[model samples]
Target: MQTVANFTPNSIVGEIEKVLDTYPYNPYQQAFSIPDIRQQLIEYVLVRIPCADSSCSVESSQENTNQVPVSKIPRTPLQHQLHLQNLIHQGICVIMQMKSELISQILCETVQPVCEPSHWFG
Candidate 1:
């Protein structure tokens, strides 16, 4: 997630627009569906949890992921599922917020209301 402190409002809004524009304009042909995004989020979140010793590497994490059910290994199936769901929800919420902010900016800057007839005829 990006913080507002990282960039000026104008730059951030432009960047977001550029990213959104890269996607397929047709909803039916979209590259990433909600389930696909959710699965990606789960994988990302799983690999990101810090190890007990605080020196976990990608290789080590993969090893842990593949390990058998040993007594020392962390094992909580339901908890893990709930955590993944939470992460997915958070990811979607952040994207929605960015889009909302971009829409608000566009409406504020580009959209105008007609207030008088004098300008309309010209």
Candidate 2:
């Protein structure tokens, strides 16, 4: 039985990195090149996903309690992989949205106010 503890966040990171590798030449790839940014996205996704067992839910797990046996429905390896891939896609969407908002805020802050032209008669 694969316990929730066995599913490390690094596994999710590895899977995400594999998908990112396919877009090596993408213009936005540089954002993920920073390890911290990539890690943040992984953390975001992990926090949103429920643990396989309620006892080890993301909320309680953060408290750093010792691992305890949890009863839950078992999923085949293929099913688990597909579920993870779906999550990776969702995480990528979130990163893109955050990047867009950041860029918009920077542009708003740096934009200069345009002066109105004086009338020729004036």
Candidate 3:
């Protein structure tokens, strides 16, 4: 896997902007790619976006000499909980952004000059 040592905030914002720019502006019907865009954004946050800390090992298991002597896991339930919350937050943020983008596209489409559909009927 290629590491993202040089990832910057501007690049992140650029990616979001790129998606927004390409988004379908049709307000009467939803964009066919909106669902795909959502999935892509979610995947980008969960997988493609690199972590700032390369030292942290998500798969590292700690040995504990405690009560039941069960197999050790990489992370605690609390960590997982926090991680899930973070993902949810990120997802919501992206969705909200898309909402604004969709609105912008709708407005832009509405403001543009309209043409008759005479070619379609003929």
Candidate 4:
């Protein structure tokens, strides 16, 4: 049984990287290829995880701040790993969903109207 101290942010990131590596690069349209997008996905998962330090807070301007207090629960290493895995999967799903919607919107905007059969024949 690993202690809470053992579950550092680096370990969490390593797990995320491992999962990301398992996914193929083609289907995402090179989304994972973009460093910023990949980092965003990692950050998404990291923000959701409870920080080990009670005083830990993200640095953001007052106008844009949306802070939420997270309650930490003690768990075994396996449970911690599982929780992170679940969060990683969810983050991937959200990214993919957004990508799909963006593609759909672009297609809708770019698609030309079809000509009638008579016009084609004429």
Candidate closest to the true structure, highest lDDT:
4
lDDT of each: 0.39, 0.59, 0.44, 0.63
What's each prediction's TM-score?
0.29, 0.55, 0.32, 0.56
Show how many residue pairs clash in every candidate, following the order shown.
0, 0, 0, 0
What is the per-residue lDDT of model 3 for residues 19-77, given as tens digits with 9 covering 90 to 100?
Answer: 44544445412432356555555555446333422322322233433321122211454
Candidate 1's C-alpha lDDT? 0.39
Q: Which of candidates 3 and 4 reaches a greater lDDT?
A: 4
Predicted model with the maximum TM-score? 4
**Ranking of models by TM-score:** 4, 2, 3, 1
Q: Model 4 clash pairs? A: none
Question: Which RMSD values do the candidates have, in order?
Answer: 13.9, 9.5, 11.2, 9.8
Q: Compared to the true structure, candidate 3 yields what TM-score?
A: 0.32
Off by over 4 Å in 1: 1-74, 101-122
| TM-score between model 2 and native | 0.55
Which pairs of residues have clashing backbones in candidate 3? none
